[model samples]
Target chain A: MGKGILVVLSGPSGAGKGTICKAFLERNKSVRLSISCTTRAPREGEVDGVNYFFTEKEEFEKMIKEDKFLEYANVYGNFYGTPKSYVEETLNSGYDIILEIDTQGALNIKESFSDGVFIFVMPPSLDELKSRIIGRGTETEETLNKRFSSAADEIKLAEKYNYAVLNDTVENAVSKIESIITAEKCKINRIKDHMDVLQEV
Target chain B: MGKGILVVLSGPSGAGKGTICKAFLERNKSVRLSISCTTRAPREGEVDGVNYFFTEKEEFEKMIKEDKFLEYANVYGNFYGTPKSYVEETLNSGYDIILEIDTQGALNIKESFSDGVFIFVMPPSLDELKSRIIGRGTETEETLNKRFSSAADEIKLAEKYNYAVLNDTVENAVSKIESIITAEKCKINRIKDHMDVLQEV
Candidate 1:
């Protein structure tokens, strides 16, 4: 409670979760986005530590064995994980951190750190979400159906989150997230100053 | 969960809780202020519904017997209580309600409606609080010490509250309270609509 909050942001692929997270970071410069560790090689134009902390497959597996990752997932033949040390150290330094992950990753983090704030970004409706995915203009009918069904599955897990933000407008969603951060700081458990100040008086 | 929140605002008399609650109400019109019912007769200028809901002693006792109050206490020679029906009705219609009560009354409400969000407001220091009370120029030295000690006692119980606002400045305190209200609304348990919407889709 003395340290900064660890916020987990999750949603469907086209729910604008990333946009809201970006807007939050822009508005609150002290808040940082967590850089994930991945076993995959860096793609073209991607920078190490900027895009991700690319690690060898053996190193990733070793970290996983050591429980260094808060949550990890195996996609295709590559592993991607959120390093626990990075998150803990950043929060200890009094900088709030936001982690953008899929629904499965979010649930994994919940098991590891139940105290972290969990937020589920949602579209106004499934129809709106379908239209948003269509607006991307790059999906085949098969992939689009897969994505639509995946989104349907993810939305059902929204109940597990502590908060839900309807991503209807970027500005409105960002404002609400900002307020949530401010309010979390005022929680009785979070204000260690109150405990210390009263002790001296 | 479809209903609005019932927020309990409580603190010592000189802690500026009233000012913060008033500021919150002015900013959020949909959030109503809860009016208590009292067996004692209203003062000359006090109006029913606007002030306290005046009640006959027998009727008040009857309501108490019938479990019609969220909480009730016999103060001095009269009984004052929060009418359960009024609070439930307001929340049922989708309007959030804030109840400004003393520390004792706040504890009483906690017993009956534990879901209500409780917030405690505090002064920067007991010395500052004493000065503010003295600035009123209406209290004798003896009364001043009583209020000061009372506030100190009340602050010790602040950890029981869901949130605490240090009233360093009226504007800052009001801003924090507003954020708290907004955050509470986003709570997963409060927004059951998210679950319902996903099911329909």
Candidate 2:
């Protein structure tokens, strides 16, 4: 075994990314979901370290100045970031880390860390996505339409991703991503140490 | 559902690649081994279409001039080559085709068909490889030593392969190669049509 893999997952709102991530974590014991640091207050029932490392705005700014975040973004006045130390520690310990992020944040991480495997999850169809968003009932007609278009934009961007895992069913998607991880670990680039040892022998 | 993958497999002698390919075909119903055209006469118990597409020397030269072969070679006055049309037709019909070639031949295919997934199989260790080769009970001491060094050279060339699957066990190597096939199919470069249709929706 070598260093752990950094898997950066991104998908649109109705793409079932969160649900799939939940199932993945439940199945793979060696993998852990990366806990994000945020200036926003945690919701009810959310654990401090488990859900998010709730941080003060000034401290978050200080972390930014210190280059402590892999990638960070401000959305609606809330600063959310992926802490650098925890991810590095987990990988150095030879445990895989899954970073669930949106497209902009994923792109930022990709630029900084080219070693991470970037995956873009997708729904089967946009029509299904529209219906799912509509089924939520919380969104008004205008917001629903906005989200539908946003999904299309995200799908277009997926062409840049290394892999596109279709979330047709949670089970199939999970298995496909699992196979991707297994295959990645066998890549020639990742097995440099193994090859070096073999060559010397 | 999509165009089939061309998997080029190569390794040193006694890597058990032949056994692994046999098991792979038994397990994967959609995949078939590619048949090459050769000027050498069919061996005892070898069928024409099943074992090889045996052709006359003139015919093989004509096909080579016609650019019908993906890669061709002359060995001990015998000509052998992978026909371009047969492989394309099989893959076009959505059946994966495996080409079992030596390191030099595999590198030639890689240069021409970048879409083809190249895999290198390896023994668990050099000592194991030496023992396996000696167990064959055919080679003299001098020839065995020559073969050992040849294997080392082949292992060095494996750095260019897309994935390296260690032949620690036939089952494990076959399973990893299957996973690699699955993962390659999910790559964004291979799913342009799916992305296009999703974008249209």
Chain B TM-scores of the candidates: 0.84, 0.87
Candidate models: Cα lDDT each: 0.84, 0.85
Can you write out model 2's per-residue Cα lDDT over B35-130, one digit (the tens) per residue?
Answer: 888888775677998778999999999999999999998743678899999899989898899988778778988999999999998888888888
Cα lDDT, model 1, residue B43: 62
lDDT of 1 by residue, A1-201 (tens): 368899998888788887888788888898989988988877667789976899999998899899999899985367889998889999998889998887888898999798799999988888888899998776679878878888888888888999988787999888888888888988888884645435534
Which pairs of residues clash in candidate 2, taking residues 3 or more apart in a chain or in different chains? none
Clashing residue pairs in candidate 1 (N, C-alpha, C atoms within 3 angstroms): none
Q: Put down candidate 2 lDDT per residue, A1-201, tens digits, no spaces.
A: 689999988877788887788898889978989989999877667789887899999999999999999999986468999999999999989899998887778888999889999998888888877777787676667767778778788778887789989988999988988999999988998986855436665
Reference-based TM-score of each model: 0.88, 0.91
| CAPRI band for model 1 | medium
In model 1 chain A, where is the ten-residue run with the lowest total lDDT?
Answer: A192-201
